[model samples]
Target: MKKVVELRCGSVDYFGIGAINRFEGIMEQYRKRGITRAGIVTGKNSYRLSGAWDVVKPVLDKTTMEYIHFDGITPNPTVDQIDEAVNLLKDIEPQLIIGIGGGSAIDASKVVAVLLKNTGKTARDIYTGRFKPFEALPTVSINLTHGTGSEVDRYAVATIPEEYDKSGAAADCMYPEYAIDDPGLMLSLPGKEVLYTSLDALNHLVEAATTKLSSPYTVMLAKEGISLIHRWLPRALNDPADLEARYWLLYASVLGGIAIDCAVVHITHPLEHTLSAFRPELEHGFGLTILLPSVIRAIYPAAGRTLSEILKPVVPNLKGTPEEAEEAASALKDWIGGLGVTQGLSDVGFSEDDLPELLKYLRKSQGESGSLSLAPLPVTDELIIRIYRESL
Candidate 1:
């Protein structure tokens, strides 16, 4: 007899090559739900560049609904920025919040919505696990970038500038009420942005599949996401106008997000978070690209078989052998390099002199156990330092 598996995603979702055209329908749903006022959260430029803002503006203009726009968000959003958005949102008291752009903007919108409903609670409280909201203002995530899966999951991330700490926060209320994944909106993304964002999605799949909480269902999603990226990312890069490639990459990112939601991410995420926390200039995906192969090499002894198996779908002609881990890691590194992202930590403005500061942030974020709980190997501080050094 064969075993059975159940798969479900909690949020209402819409995906199509040109699904962005349905934005007006989403607005109608919000109105039907008795939402009279809406808040739109997005980056300063992405929504405009992608023409999403133009499409949205007319919809809002024609409707009776009152709306406010918050476009101050930046990449690697800080807790302080969330507080700023929250302060503004509380004033308008919208019934619904719409998050647009990439992960940073979407994440900011989620945290801001939570703080708005649960007044008097700060982002610091959420980041430190002191305040967990039971309810948040309804949210709709409109994805303009195929990265971070923030559009579909309950997980939201923020950084503390003072402590240089970056962490994830989860609450039942944090999940968006609806997700809009339109590959057409992603067409305007710069080549480097596409590369970095796709890499982030790939990292999400890899980390989710390798985590201890991984199950057959989540692993299947991870493998499919990896395969999609391996096949389409390069093609998307080669021809940005290829709607077919863009559609599949966006689909892969959704799978990656769903996989992480079910299985959680591992060390690579925390390490990259620390790196970006210290060096805010470093894009999250770029940092992951630099560190991924090194981290894979570090953990191969403990998780070689599993890593090898999981990677076979993405790595062509991968043999099911003891050396599979090494081959997979090498292939992945070559792929990343082929995409023209071969920068090391030093190349990105890190030095041995900065190691102590970076280490401090890493220790504070991951704590004594480091990322060992999620990693297959015993991830010691020494090993982490070695990985950083090797990445450099």
Candidate 2:
């Protein structure tokens, strides 16, 4: 039997079945703050189609709070998108900001909240540190998918389409003040999204468990998260309406998010950020799935013991060696392939010719998130190229 769990991390998160009830309490707090205007950030359709808008609009109405929304959020949100959203949302002078979709939408909402509070600051200005603000407007995330833990973590990512630069930032002010994760709301996910989001959560577990700062907390959360995903992801995909499965998968995602918040995702997130930048069409989780096995092999030297322990759900008998890492990577590839995420970087329009540029942006991208430093070993140019080639 699953019970509703309320976790207080940087953000207070409500996870499990019927967790949507907590939204009223959140809005009550805003009402008491005399927050009259609310700004919403969500994708074009998922906000409505996922049944979130139907469930949330009434609460705001009861509070008699005025609200405005930017429904233009997309899969991989861009700098222009965020800058434009900030420009549009500035008219309302919102006191509260709510991000109501997956990572892309929630990440954009976090960026908008930051821009709104630090008036006249562009998304680029804050992300690049040309204008570093000490505070941001309080925000909430009504998380719709089970992948990105953006609701609970202080990190946000967006791509610069023109320069092919993807920006990721971690700051104290970026975390949502309140968040929701209701499994009932997750039933609207399509098959592809269900697989992709679950893969995203699984990769988070693997990478977070092995970072240089892997604490007992990180490893414990990651192991349980990975195990839950293994047992439940396929069930949800097979029976898309499985509330129990959705509960566990979303719970696992929360665990992964909290794990990464403490340990931080290292090499995989850095490289995947670059991959999606190279080809913006590639989904974040899709890029992670394609490169995960290669990442599993690359980090083994530094993280073998951790990998061997947490990964036992999939590769049950791993002995945690260089040879076993290869075996584990192959096994993971086969597992993910079975779920239909078999595309390599080449399949998604990346090639050897893009190598030099990918490297240049990767260097720039790594500096902000500092994910590369947390890696067990130096992710040299040669090794990066090798990982790219192997994924190809």
* Tens digit per residue, CA lDDT, model 2, 1-392: 14222232798888878888788888999989998898899889998988888878998898887888899988888878998888888888999998999999999998899899988778877666677657889999999999888889988888876666676777789889988999888899898889889889988888878877667777888899999998998899899999899999999998888888777878778888888877777888889898899988898877888889898888899877776778888998898887788789889888898887887888876333488787888879888888888998
The 10-residue segment with the lowest total lDDT in model 1: 1-10
How well is each residue in 117-170 modelled by candidate 1, as lDDT tens digits? 888899999887788788999898989888778898888888998888887887
**Alpha carbon lDDT of each predicted model:** 0.82, 0.84
Give the poorly placed runs of model 2, Cα more than 4 Å off: 1-8, 366-369
Worst 10 residues of 2 by lDDT: 1-10
Question: What local lDDT does model 2 show for residue 190?
Answer: 90
TM-scores for all predictions: 0.94, 0.95
- The predictions' CA RMSDs to the true structure, in order, are 2.4, 4.0
Residue 148 in candidate 1, Cα distance off native in Å: 1.5
Highest-TM-score candidate: 2
Best by lDDT: 2
